[model samples]
Target: MTEYSEISARLAALPDAELTTVLQAATVGRPAFWAVRAALDEMAGVGHIAPGGDVSPTTESVQTHDQASGGGASGQVGAASAVPVVPVHPAGIPASPAAGGYSSGGVPTFESVRDKVEQRFGTAQGMGELDRQTPAGRSADEQWEAREKAARERLDQIRKSVHDNDNP
Candidate 1:
């Protein structure tokens, strides 16, 4: 009935690949993530921290030594507290994924490649009418193979032309 619950439900329904994407997205631009992680250590009876060790944040209840004095402590505590060493995927890498599990010009995972394909072309359902025009039971895969061969042949011709131009 609540917003969190709704989000949780929707997240639950998604397949694993989509879930991975959402989890990856949530970590971005969220400095608070590191603070909570530090707070958890204190909750497990870690009263004192090193001069400058990692500190996680917890709910408002997990107060530090300075908090009892006044409202200054309150300023520090909240949901977005815990911070991690590496931001999971911090820099150089991108937030919006291209394809697959592989990042940074790497080959995409199968699902990521499929997702890209669907985004560029229409969905399977959207292509259904066109597919029906093909012989029944002749899958999309079959058509793709034929098309790929044709593309390769065309690419070979282009390559030969370029090679001849440079050499002659």
Candidate 2:
């Protein structure tokens, strides 16, 4: 059977409780979540849902699904799908064919940024996230500012510890 047909059958076979579990675990804006959502919409559109339920596709839902799936009727997939299948170095930087490819020259590549940030601020950021959870009256921006402050403080403490260790 075709992949879509297999997916449809699998979707059909999924018990309501299991389907609900899957839905609960699915994160919004993720491809897998969008795929399941689209499949459900398609199934409902084709009269697969029980008669008592509201299975009719709303214009908003249809538009959302179409956008998420890269708008088949628009003659091209959405911009998200337009990204190259293979990871490539940013423009003007030729990628190395060697394992763990390097960008042109010793200049920092996009991939290295995450590792550097984590190495520098991971502990502090973790503490900051926890700190932001408290002090409930603050707005999101304020909370973020507080988190940054906490991270800075933690980083300072780390620097002091490292300096002390080196001097002693």
Candidate 3:
């Protein structure tokens, strides 16, 4: 009488070899793979699987002046006095929103600095992420790991260069 009942009857008739093949293709842990798993689970009279949940992206962000602020007014507008003048880079000038704020441009704010960096460098630091394999496809995790590795390597390079310059 129900849609699930029809599927259950069909699955029950499946040969052992065919069922194994279907399970192999289900991809229990992959995206969209879960839809197949859920269906298979229903066919096998399996109970609910507690959603393992999603893994969110971990950003590699350094502290800005706002983060160090201790005052209640720090996170709001007109908190410029408390806002730290964060350096755009180790060698570059500090971010300043100019006297007129965004109304007039001199030294840009942190948001502007990020935009300019992207414009000059292109997306994902020119890592060519979209050109890589999808997570469901092979090499997806490896490509992401490679990007993180490259960033860490660049940070190490920056640290070393600054350290070397300090002595000279």
Top candidate on TM-score is 1
- The alpha-carbon deviation from the true structure for residue 156 of candidate 2, after best TM-score superposition, in angstroms, is 0.2
Residue range 1-168, candidate 1, lDDT tens digits: 699999999999985444544554564455545334324333422333336645772223333322344444347634323532221333454444642355544555677677788776776666776766677636766878899999999999999999999995
| Every model's TM-score | 0.21, 0.20, 0.20
| Model 3 lDDT-worst window of ten | 57-66
- Candidate 3 matches the true fold with a TM-score of 0.20
Candidate 2, residues 1-168: lDDT per residue as tens digits? 699999878878996544544553553445434435545544423323445866573322222222345445546533223321222334454545532323444345566677778777988888778766776634776867999999999999999999999995
Candidate 1 lDDT (Cα, 0 to 1): 0.53
What's the distance in Å from true for residue 151, model 2? Answer: 0.1
Global lDDT of model 2: 0.53
lDDT of 1 at 87: 17
Per-residue C-alpha lDDT of model 3 across residues 130-166, encoded as one tens digit per residue: 6555554347677678999999999999999999999
C-alpha positional error of residue 120 in candidate 1 after TM-score superposition, expressed in Å: 47
